[model samples]
Target: MAKSGNKMATLLNLILVLSLVLMISIAESRKLGEEAVACDSVYGAEEGDTCESVIQKFQLGADFFLSINPNLNCDNFFVGQWLCTEGTVN
Candidate 1:
């Protein structure tokens, strides 16, 4: 009986953690952009791609690249994500 009770408690804790993660993910996605924005120029981040490397590849500066992508972190994006290379109206 104690073993079963421990399992139930563990399951409940797991559910609560998953729910909090899901809620935070939803909020963050909305913050990033609710809808996709059209891109004049775009870059698909490949493995080991960094802000400096990308800007160098495109012949742009760090400030320019970061400026075009507001609310974005230079080193916090996932691989294979597409980013706008040019600034677009929201």
Candidate 2:
């Protein structure tokens, strides 16, 4: 009986932790979406567009770009990916 109770408690704890993580993830994603929507200026990635190229084209600092596009995976960036070129996300 004690062992069963322990297992149940562990399972409940896992569920609670997972729920909190999921809630946090959803909130973060919503925040990022809001920031993207609030962007005053936007840019689309082109075939040969690198992060450096985009930064140079838009005259943005690397840190600023990262700050505005928190979800951007520069290493895995693809064509047609929209970026916030100017925004209040800073």
Candidate 3:
């Protein structure tokens, strides 16, 4: 019974450690994505990409994005669309 309990405790500890590592890895990837340089650069829209997500990834405000990209359809996203990022950067 004691050995079984110890095994369970070790398994629980391993699970916790793995969970923490996975969380950290996810966070780091998000951080790297958010650090993209969009200022004065033209970005091509990828599949499943949204204008809001792109703006957020570049740390841009809606107003700033609009000012740089005149006549842009920000409400809808199209793959292969070119986006100008003049005043938007992380």
List per-candidate RMSD values in Å: 10.2, 8.1, 11.5
> Please, what are the lDDT tens digits per residue for candidate 1 over residues 1-86?
99999999999999999999999999876856443445588889888888888888888867667767666777687888786787
lDDT of 2 by residue, 1-57 (tens): 999999999999999999999999998767443544357788889998888889999
Root-mean-square deviation of Cα positions for candidate 2 versus the true structure, in angstroms: 8.1
Model 1 lDDT on a 0 to 1 scale: 0.78
Q: In model 2, how large is the Cα lDDT of residue 2?
A: 100
Residues 1-90 of candidate 3: C-alpha lDDT, one tens digit per residue: 999999999999999999999999998767553334444687888887777888887888877776677667866878889888665445
The best candidate by lDDT is 2
lDDT-superior candidate, 1 or 3: 1
TM-score-better candidate, 1 vs 2: 2
After TM-score superposition, the amount by which residue 24's alpha carbon in candidate 1 deviates from its true location, in angstroms, is 28
Candidates ranked by TM-score: 2, 1, 3
Model 2, residue pairs in steric clash: none
**Runs in model 2 with CA error above 4 Å?**
1-37
How many times do residue backbones clash in model 2?
A: 0
What lDDT would each prediction earn against the true structure? 0.78, 0.85, 0.77
